[model samples]
Target chain A: MKNSNENKFLSPGHNACAGCGQLSAAQAVMRGLNENIIIANATGCLEVTTTAYPQSAWGLPWIHSLFENAAAVASGILASLKQKGDKKTKVVVQAGDGGTFDIGLGLISGMWERGENILYICYDTEAYSNTGIQASGSTPYGASTTTTPDGSASIGSTQGKKDMLAIALAHGVKYVAQTTTGFPDDITNKVKKALSVEGPSYIQILCPCIPGWKINNDQAVMMGKSAVQTALYPLLEYSDGQLISSSLKKGFQARPAGEYLKNQGRFKHLKDKDISLIEKLAQANIDKYKI
Target chain B: MKNEKVSLITKPNTTLANKTGAWRTAKPMTDLLTCIGCSLCAKICPEGCIVMGEISESAANGKKLKPKNKKLKPKTDYNYCKGCGLCTHECLVKAIKMIKDY
Candidate 1:
């Protein structure tokens, strides 16, 4: 779409965390989209920020649904658009990790399985960020949350995040990618590319949340960049059943998952062995990608 | 204006966004992984500040994903940069910048 300031985009007054990665991601998305598209945000941070009753921050035709059913809502949007012959406008589903990785996983999978023509972007901050900093399915192992706090007995989030791109790829969809708030260009470029693609596309973003992870607000962006640079989150894409190119191929220095943990009070109680174990997690990521 | 080397993204209503630059300058960031080799960033650039040339063609996606190391190795036309971080913010992967230098 032609760039124009007059075209209404993200509305004002919606409360999002200052320097919020999701907002940055959302802004990047606006840059990629044509400005005429409608977004269906899940009942997470984005929805809460945009549709607070009388005051809404969204600049487009937006809908907010339950935590786990944004995909269904987007599907309905596509189906309704098709029924009305509204071909010019595209529909987008925006959800958080809680909505996508946890509660909404089944519906999201179903939507992709059906080859729904829409863009579903998951802002995976790795937890249920809006609701009291709880753990979600995507929460990394050993990172503490309200419920998964480090203690004498357990490693926080024992399992690793559900592999989203693989999940999307498994659905046999047209396009899928793993992205992060770390690189704005990478995020926008992918969004633009996905917009151009005709079939269903899933963009899984490794968004960082200050409060949820108990990280310093200033560290949010840096942490995002760290995740990608450290090989903890590799930037890759899959298309037509083939693994394509990767981003930042020069690769990055491996930072400690402890570095990611130290900033947040969540992992404050972690013992040295716990830190070492998390370090192993980081090493495993590097080994898996062979970086 | 003195710090030409840094990024500066103002709040809305001050400058240009992808759709709302009626009275401001908002630049875009390019997320490397998310970029799909579309020339939209270059095309949308009002001042040719974006060197789409840096976009890497990943060995994986033969025709997709642009040049790599854009952040550390970009050749921007700063006179044309306009202090609008539309390119930085527009990036799906969040790679562009309108920030002032530290």
Candidate 2:
């Protein structure tokens, strides 16, 4: 779709948090999409915040399905469109990490296994922000949430983040990409590329949450940028089972993970050992992704 | 008596009727003197509330600037700005400031 100031699919005026990374990423996603699209949104922050009673932020044809059935709904929409012989119209599934990584995985897998023509976009906010900041499967280690508080006895969530990208790749998806809210253009380009593909595509975005991350609202973009620069969440893309592009460059040394962690209250209670553990995690990502 | 069912669909794009600026606790005030009319604030504004228009002479700080290349200034439609302060933070010259909504 052409990027014009006057042509926006996701017009602002919803109840998204100020400086919300998800909303910004959603805007970028909308920019990448053409007018002939139908979106099946899972029940989450994006769905709830955008579609309050009698108001909606989406300019496109949108539907809010059950939290775990967005992929299924999109698959149905694809089937209907195909039956109608509307080859030009696109089908998209938008969901949060809770819906994508945990609740809706089975249905999403089914959609991919069926080789449906759909684009699934997951906004990874780490935790369930809309539901009082509870921990989700995608929540990173050492981050505190209401369900996984960092007290003297605990260092927040004990488990590491689930590798959803690897799972997507394993699903034989032709197009799979991972980006963060730090890079709006990257998100837009990835969405455009995913939409161009004929079969199932998945793009996961690391959208920083203000309340969930316990960071100031203004720090969402900074935190997103830091998350990438620190090598904790590098931008990556895989096309047809091959690594095609990455955001990391040669001689690109990562900033300390603490630089990304220190600004957030979620990691406030982390001890030096915890910070070192997180640093080790970042290092592992750097080594694995070859950033 | 025949029963009537309520239509599930309402008019599309009716969200424009909802004035969300009332939810803002703080409002952004743009400094026309420092603003270079680069339109970064408008580009970064998630609310799509910032509109670029001709700079007024009173706010021009007596620069005797001719309108070249549509030298514009950002005027926010507070009707939807949520006081995110993103525009303020993203401003290259720090031209935008967040003041009390009152």
Candidate 3:
């Protein structure tokens, strides 16, 4: 389907940055959702920008919950729908990486453990972008942020990104997928696939932040694509406990990780050693996924 | 004065009343002569302010016409466009230009 004009659920007049990858990804997510859907959006860039006081960009039935309670709010909504015998309606919780990997982990786990029928989407911008680009659980290693500034004797963040995908699998979610803004169709297809499953599902989309990543406004899409092509953030999918698909394939000549890092000012501080370290990390993913 | 409770709820679509055009430092001007009428700009616009509309005959006649096919050009709703320039960037023929808003 056409990306534009097909989905009017997420109207476009709000104040997201020009060429905001998250907003583009959100539009793709909307394409997969039907009319009988309700969204519980967590506090983040998406929530703050879309619902600025009296103005709202949401064309669907949506509720803004606290940063850590979107999953819980969705659970409650699902319960109410169940009580009303409304099986046709779907409940979706949309959160940022901070909400999913850190603040809301407990509640998300609780909802998943209860086996609620909900589709949870995490727009992983890699840092707490709304709060001025602070480090979050999903922030990559050696990346500069407000809190993890690269200085003398410092290479930005010291820790690796948290593997939230494994956490979802541990929670026994039936369907889980990871995609980036580079592939809009993949995101839409995965969301549709996740919603088709009977139990809880999860999708994490790598939405490159413009100001946070220190890239030009028009470079978000290109950065997202490079991220996948470099295998730094490979497109991935899992059904039940099995890996159904991964974009990283054997014999596929991977683009140098430096290509992905060089454009963004956030990674400008990286030295040869840091680039190799990131390359090693991507190689490790390739090995693990057998791609 | 009596203490009164205030309701935070406002009517839906109140956002529509807001004319965000004031936020533009640069404005996108579409050059119909260079435009291919591909609608890529309209498709990629983050703000759904761009719409494909019928091209006037006089305006079409002023340009070198591809006589076989009738095409629709995109028009911008400045009331909502924040002048993000996504459309200008996506335009293949360089039809859209971001000029000083004033």
Candidate 4:
């Protein structure tokens, strides 16, 4: 539809779930991008919903290849731009946590090793939402998924979420940041900052899934904010292997982890003791990242 | 490149043809009197259909207001709203409500 406030990058009418946190976070990401850019999207919910057959919601040049090769595709794009002597247009890679943490990790490491000036954004849904909510490397402990369903004997996923920021830092990425869909402005600003830096950068955004997290449509944003407030997934930024900013500052009082866990069906099976264990995890993050 | 060698690339914004409002079971209606012009709804809309618009004279007719301060309000494009109810839930002043679309 014709309107004054049409989103320049991502247009409306894509088939993403209503109030989808990933889509909303992507909206913010688009706001940070200028017209002179190309995006390499990995196979996931963002790629599937936006580019259907002969239709595309993206207003800019966008490409989708495979789940595990978006970084490679972005590298190729950067190489082509370099060969063409086109220094203006920037390259970016967008992938879900499945693609970033599990499938595309090797290729992403290779890209970072070369130190290509590309921004890699990971939409951390914590599970493979497009594949019917299967647990991935980013799935937090005590959260239920299709593969790690909670039952009489099992308490959902057994492992904790991977520290992707630290891994990105280990690769000597120039910029690394973490944000949630709750903070749209923060996501946009961080995207701008990452693009400003002239080397490999990584940004991971916590995007809640309605069906995967088993939350109400409106609860996605609330859950994202609660995740940060509970310090379960704190807002963080790193520069050249040094901590630049974080949410776990001295004055910050973390909300009880239970407030965030009890709101989602994925964590519904967690007991009081299990909740306490999760609390300890958040506490450890607090201690580890204390400023 | 010849036409026969063309790849299957699509045009930008061609997905606009798919009017997603048909998927909505509810409609968000806003009370302008209580709106504080925050535009949170416009920012959080997944469809990117909500926009901030100037309050028209008729829209502000019933409510008494200082003419010196004209406030902007969120206007949703129903053609793509999808009735997610996020705007209604996140409204700062509880001005938006989700009513049955039927």
Q: Positional deviation of A267 in candidate 4, in angstroms?
A: 0.6
Q: State the displacement of the C-alpha of residue B40, model 4, in Å, after optimal TM-score superposition.
A: 1.3
Worst 10 residues of 1 chain A by lDDT: A1-10
Per-prediction TM-score: 0.71, 0.92, 0.89, 0.96
In the range A1-291, model 2's lDDT, one tens digit per residue, is: 122354357776778888888987887787789988999999999998878777777788999869999999998999899899999999999999999999999999999999898999999999999999999999999989999998889999999999999999888999999998777778889999999998989999999888888787777667878999998999999999787887666777889888899889999998888899999998888777763
Per-prediction DockQ, in order? Answer: 0.04, 0.39, 0.29, 0.58
Candidate 4 positional error at A99, Å = 0.2
Instruction: Please report the candidate that would top TM-score against the real structure.
Output: 4
Local error of candidate 1 at residue A267 (angstroms): 2.7
Q: What lDDT tens digits, residue by residue, belong to model 1 across residues A167-188?
A: 7888887778887776667887
Candidate 3's C-alpha runs over 4 A off are A1-7, B1-5, B8-10, B29-44, B51-59, B62-75, B90-97
lDDT of 2 at A14: 74
Judging by DockQ, tell me the better candidate of 2 and 4.
4
Summing lDDT over every window of 10 consecutive residues in candidate 4 chain A, give the lowest-scoring window.
A1-10
Candidate 4 lDDT by residue in tens digits, B1-102: 666755588899999999999999999998777788877788878888988777776777766666432666778889999998988888878999999996
Q: For each prediction, how big is the interface RMSD? A: 10.0, 3.9, 4.1, 2.5
> In candidate 2, what fraction of native interface contacts survive?
0.33
lDDT of 3 by residue, B25-102 (tens): 889999876787787666555565677776666766676567422567787889878877767766778888989986
